[model samples]
Target: MPIKAQMEQLQRVTSLSVALEWVTGCPDLAGRDTVLKLIGEEVSTTIQGVIYSAESKGGGGAEMA
Candidate 1:
């Protein structure tokens, strides 16, 4: 499947702990901090993308005063 399709599939999935476990099992990381940092960055980027898309489509809610 294409990356877009894979991402859409991921969006439909809700078991984050399972996903986190799979990601952390990758051999290339070789360290806890590296896995943690990469996960943190990816999560931050995903959240930012969601926020940006929502704002661009005028679906984002108003900020509190």
Candidate 2:
């Protein structure tokens, strides 16, 4: 599957294991690296609350936001 389509599938799934499975099942190492990079960027943005800034709760004693 194309990486974009694979990533869409990964987003629809709720489990990290399932996402990992998608990555591992990729036939091309370069494709896996690209997908992993995208995932990492998404994860980092989520962790920093940059993706959810509109709903940010003002840190609330947490490091996010």
Q: In model 2, which regions exceed 4 Å deviation?
A: 1-17, 50-65
Task: State candidate 1's TM-score.
Answer: 0.51
| lDDT tens digits, residue span 10-57, model 1 | 573434435677776777766756766766676666656655654655
Best by TM-score: 1
What CA RMSD would you report for each candidate? 6.7, 9.3
> Candidate 1: which stretches are off by over 4 Å?
1-17, 21-30, 63-65
Tens digits of per-residue lDDT, candidate 2, 1-65, equal 34464455455444544677789889999999998887777666544443244235334436643
Whole-model Cα lDDT of every candidate shown, in order: 0.58, 0.59
Candidate 2 collision pairs: none
Candidate 1 CA-lDDT value: 0.58
Model 2 CA lDDT for position 33: 95
